[model samples]
Target: MEETKIFLITYFAALLGVVPPGLVNMSVAKTCVKRGKKNGIYMAFGASFIVLLQAALAIMLARYIFDNTYINNVLLRAGLVIFLIMMFYFLLMAQRKRKEVEVTPTSGFRSILKGMMIGVLNIFPIPFFVALAAALNVHGDIEYHLLNNTAFVLAASLGTFTTLYLYALFFAKIEAEGTYFARYSNYFMAALMLILVVITFIRIFSQ
Candidate 1:
């Protein structure tokens, strides 16, 4: 049951984390529009493959931080500040205009390589997962063991793929309604960050 909970938490985190129109998913959608769903799916697979590595690296970093009591405590306090910053950043993003995604055409296995390249360029996942791991650790929701860590990485990768697949599957609708979706998604992210801020603050004070 605990393992399942860890899996679900990490899965949903990755899923919702990618819901906002971003480089990878937006590229997937654009690929679907310009090339085809097949290519887009291929790209998602490639990106998800990289997510596996990124998640693993993040968990490893989180484990290192967790091993040091002083650092962990400091990070929790720092997390509170970071969460507050993220809240305002997302709120600002919500008010900004979203730009159209431009995709270059690719086909076959090359699409996968293209996706891999794009995934490599996206540097947000590692820190995001690290912070999430820290927060979950504080809540006793995650254990840094082999089984739990594996589940977390696998779930995160699968979650990313699922979101990208959905973007590919619904490219037309997404293209039509993307601005509104992104705006609201940013607002939602801002709200979520605020909640994290509160949680981090309480965790820090309680320690």
Candidate 2:
């Protein structure tokens, strides 16, 4: 029961960790609205592929760090702190630009690559995945361990990408309806991200 509970929590948390907003989702939504659903799905898949790569890398790094408890804990803590700070900054900036921003079209593979780059460059996902791997605690030959990690990462990527796809689709529909909420999603999403960051910090520090 305890083991199952841990896995459930870690899996759900990992899913939440990758959900996009602010710059990433905003760009995708605008692109999808301006271009079409086909382009939007492509952008999502491209971005999600990169996210899977990040999660894979983070899993490898986590395995390496697991041998050293102090180093692992310190790195995890530092990562959490950094992630929170970045999220806060994003929130503030979006709030500041709530009214001045316009949704511009970006519906190409290049735009998809851009979103992936931004998502990967944001290092918060690294430690987030590391923490999940630590929680999962797979033990075996390196290859087996890697497979386990990959499974978790894939699950997370699916959840995150689904969220992105749904959000983009919703925004696209809103745009079609000539609603303004599509343009202002960034502000709301940023605020939600800030809350997530704070909550994550609290959870990490409490541990």
Candidate 3:
């Protein structure tokens, strides 16, 4: 029962986390618009693969991360820098000519690689899962046993994949209905990244 609870909690938390239109899912949606659903799915798989490892690491290091204020502050600072970089990257992409944004065919491997690269670039998940794990531990709702942790990791990965897959699946229809969203997806991403950057900056200084 405890293991089941942990799995459910972690799964829903992860699912909700990715439901927001953010970097990985936005990238997946863009790929679907530019390439195809198959490539988008491949990318989702690649991103989820990284989530598996990240979830595991977070759970394992939960206590240590929670206890170390310096490490936490450093991570926040690093995340701020990363968010700023991503914000600029998306802003630049938004400025490119339509011809430059034309769809290009790519292999599944390449799609997967792109997904993994984006996943790596997104560092927020590590701290998020770490905090979740620490909270669960403090509440006596989680056990660090192998089976429980395995379930937690698997759930996190699956939840992320599910959200990404949905984004890949419906993006085309969304694009057809909302031309603005399609045309300004990069700008939307840049805006979201800027928001993240602001939030991270506040957190760093407030701490």
Candidate 4:
């Protein structure tokens, strides 16, 4: 019970940590709202599907590295710096790309495939999971470690999707009322994420 709780807390905390990507979530919510709930649900699932894959992969990789001290240290530091930089870049780019863009559906199965690709290509998760593993002091057999990692990520992913879905519903309401959130929202989110990035960098360097 205690171990389970710890894993759950760590996982959810990590998810919260990742949630600074408000633009992405807002984008998803806005698209879903514009397209109607049926389509929005699909987008949510599509976007989140990538998260599932990432969590699984992270679990495996974390387990592998945890058992190897040299690799773990190297990956821990390198992954930390690289992931933080990428997340900072993501925020900066998101801010620059803040103009409302059309969300188009691809033909047939291609749409789903594209969503999966978009989700998978989001590599910001790798270092975050690696950092989580280090923070949690995860180590040992592949199976056991993977299980622990998977559990944490799954919990975190659940929290992330839940937050997005609720945001989608809220955005749908706003769309229904024909009001738009100001562009400043994007800037604000970006600024907040930038602060997080700086803090993460400081932690990485200081460590």
Best by TM-score: 3
| For every candidate, C-alpha RMSD to the true structure in Å | 7.6, 5.9, 2.0, 5.8
User: What shift in Å separates residue 30 of candidate 1 from its native position after superposition?
Assistant: 1.3
Every candidate's lDDT: 0.77, 0.62, 0.86, 0.56
- Decide which is better by lDDT, 1 or 3: 3
* C-alpha TM-scores of all predictions: 0.63, 0.59, 0.91, 0.58
Q: Mind giving the per-residue lDDT tens digits that candidate 3 earns over 58-143?
A: 88888888789898898888888888998999899888876534456589999999999999888889999998888777867555
Over 1-207, each residue of candidate 2 has an lDDT whose tens digit, in order, gives 434444355456755654545445655675676556666666777777777787777777886765666764675566556556656665665566344344455557776776686566455666667766776666542342544555666765775677778766876676655335445544555565566566656755666
User: Clashing residue pairs, candidate 4?
Assistant: none
lDDT of 4 by residue, 40-100 (tens): 5555566566776676666567756545666645644564455455556656665674456
lDDT of 3 at 126: 93
Candidate 3, which segments miss by more than 4 Å at Cα?
100-103, 175-179
> Model 3, poorest ten-residue lDDT window?
172-181
Please give the TM-score that candidate 4 achieves against the real structure.
Answer: 0.58
Clashes of each: 0, 0, 0, 0
Candidates ranked, most accurate by lDDT first: 3, 1, 2, 4
lDDT of 2 at 83: 55
Full-model lDDT, candidate 1: 0.77
